[model samples]
Target: MKNFIIICFLLLVGHQTVNAQKALRVYVVRHAEKLTGDPKEKDPELSPEGSERAQALAKELKGQKIDSIFSTNYKRTKLTGFPLADKIGISIKTYNPDQTKALATQLIENAKGKNILIVGHSNTVLEIIEAFGGEKPVKPLTDDDYDYLFTVTVKGKKVEVKTSRYGASHHTEGGEAKAMKSNK
Candidate 1:
C-alpha cells in the first residue's frame, strides 16, 4: 500500500509539471514599415524597409512553437505575419479591428495554455497590450524607428511583460514620447 501511494503521488506531480510547461505566451507586435506612396490609398503595402523589418522580426521569433497567428485585414499586417506563419506552418486569421478587445478576449480564452501571436496597427497594438492588463501606453514609431517588441506571458492569473526597442538606447514606463538613450 505504501509503494502504491508513492507511485500515485509521482504521477500527479508529473502531470502538473507538464501542464505548467504548456502555459500560453502571446506576442503583440506593430506592423512593420509601410510604403511611402499616397496616403489616400485604401490599403498600402510594406515599404522596402518594412519588408526588411518583417524579415528581421521573423528571425527574432524563429525556433518558437507559435500555435496561432492573428492579424487585421490590412495588407501591412498580413505581410508582417507571413514569414512567421510560414515558418510555423499555420495560416493567419483576420480579426475585426473595431472588435479588437472582444476578439483578443476570445482568443485568449481559446488559447488557454497555448502560445499565440498577434500583429496589429500602430493605433491598436498598444490597446491590445492594455487589454491584456499591460500598464504601458501605446507609442508611435518614427520613420526611423522599427524595433519595438512586446513579449507578454500569462501563467494562470499572473502576467509578465518585457520590451525591446530596435535602435533606441533606453526604456520608459507608460508614455509614448521618444527618449534618448542614457550616455552611461
Candidate 2:
C-alpha cells in the first residue's frame, strides 16, 4: 500500500510537469521597413535595408522550431516573414486584420505546445496581444520602424506576457506601451 501511494504521487508530479511544458510561446512582431514611396504604390517591396533587417530577424529565429507563421495579406508583412518562413520550412498563413482577435485566439489554441510567429501592422499588433491577455500595449511604429516583439506564454486558460525589442537601428528601444486587456 505504501508503494502504491508513492507511485501515485510520482505520477501526479509527472503530469504537472508535462502540462507545464505544453504552454505555448508566441512571438508577435511588426513588419520590417518598407521602401519610401507613395502610400498608394501597388505592391511595394522591401528596401535594401529592410531586406537586411529581415535576414537578421530570420537568423535570430533560426532553429527555434517555429510551428506556424501568421502574416497580414499585405506585401510588407509577407516580405517581412519570408526569410523566417524559409528558414523554418513553413508557409505564411494570412489572417484578416478585421478578425484579428478571433484569429489570434484560434491561433493560440491551435498552436498550444508549439512556437508560433506573427507579423502584424502597427495598429493591430497591440490588439492581438491584448486578445491573448498580454499586459503591454503595442508600441508606436513609424514607416521605417519595426522592432517590437511580443512573447506570449499560455498555460491552460492563463497567459503570461513578455515584451522584447529587435531591429533597434530604426527605433528607440523600450517605451511604455498601453495594453488594452480584455477577455473578449
Candidate 3:
C-alpha cells in the first residue's frame, strides 16, 4: 500500500508538470504596407497591396486554431488583423500599442497554452517581441519592412522566437525571404 501511494503521487506530479510545459504559440506581425506620400493623413486605410497582404496573412494562418486575435486600435492594424479574425470567426480585440508591458503581462498570464495573433506597427513590433521575453530582430523594422512574421513560443518562462516572411518580397533584391530563430 505504501509503494502504491508513492507511485500514484509521482504520477500525479508528473502529469501536472507535463501540463505546465504546454507551449503557447504567438504569431506577431507588423501591419502590412501602408499608403505613403501623405503627410496630412494621420490614419490611412490599407493600400491595395496592403489589402492583398492582409488576405495572404489570413491564408497563412488559417486552420491553425488561433484562439484569439489582438490588434492595435488603428486603421492599419485593425485592417491587418480583420481578415484572419473573420476567417477564424473571432473578433479582433483592440489593444493600446503603447502599453507593451501590460499587454505582454496579460498575454503571459492568461494566454498560456493558446494561440494568439498580434498586429502591430514597425516601431512597436520589436518592443512587443521583447516585452513577451522573445528575441527581437537584430535590426529594427523599418517603414518599408512589412513582410516579416514573428512566431514566439512561450513555455512557462522559456521563450523561442522564429522570424520568417509571407506575401511579396519587400527586400531590395527580391530574393526568397530567410528565417531566423532564437531561444531564451
Candidate 4:
C-alpha cells in the first residue's frame, strides 16, 4: 500500500513536469530602413544602408536555429527578413499587418517548441510582444531606430521578455514615411 501511494505521488509530479515544460522562443524586430521615393510610391524597397544592415542581421542570427521567418506583406519587411531566411535556409512567410492578433495566436499555437523570427513595423512591434502575453510595455520606435531586437520566451504561464540591439543605426525624423517600407 505504501509503494502504491508513492507511485501515485511520482506520477502526479511527473505529469506536472510535463505540463510545465511547453516553451516557445520568438525573436522580433522592426524592418530596416527604406529608400525615399515618390509620393505615390507606397511600397519602397530598402535603402543601401538598410540592405547592409540586413546582411549584418543575418550574420548576427546565423548560429541560431531559426525554424521560421515571418514578415509583413510589404517590401521593406520582406527585405529585412530575406537575409535571415537565407542564412537559416527557410523561406520567408508573409503575414498581414492588419491581422496581428490572429498571426500572434497562430504562432503561439503552431509555433510552440520552435524558434521563430518576425519582422514588423515600429508601431506594430509592441503589439506582437503584448499579444504573446509578454511583460512590460514599450513605446513606438522612431524613423531612425532600426536596431531594436526583442526576444520573448514563453514557458507555461511565465513569459519573459528582453530587448537587444542589432546591426547599424539610421535615424530619421519629421513627416510620415512613404512606401510603407521602413515606416509603414
Model 4: pairs clashing at backbone N, Cα or C within 3 Å: 42-179, 43-179, 144-171
**Which one wins on lDDT?**
3
Q: Mind giving the per-residue lDDT tens digits that candidate 3 earns over 53-114?
A: 99999999997799999898889999999999998888999998878789888888777789
> What's the TM-score of each model vs. the native?
0.75, 0.77, 0.83, 0.79
Which 10 consecutive residues of model 1 have the lowest summed lDDT?
Answer: 166-175
Backbone clash total, candidate 1: 0
C-alpha RMSD in Å of predicted model 1 compared with the true structure: 6.1
- Model 4 C-alpha lDDT per residue in residues 1-184, reported as the tens digit of each score: 9999999999999976765686788898889889887768889999998998888889888787889998999999999999988777789998887888898778776666778889998888988898889964456776667877899998876899998777764322332333334654
Q: What's model 3's lDDT at 22?
A: 84
Tell me the whole-model lDDT of each prediction, alpha carbons only.
0.75, 0.77, 0.86, 0.82
Better of 3 and 4 by lDDT: 3
The backbone clash count of each candidate, in order, is 0, 1, 0, 3
* Candidate 1 C-alpha lDDT tens digits along 1-184: 9999999999999977766655568788888878868979878998887788788778888766788888999999999889888877899999887897797677556566767778987777777777776656345554434567787776666667777754222344543445655799
What's the residue-level lDDT of 122 in candidate 4?
83
Model 1, runs deviating above 4 Å: 1-22, 137-145, 166-184
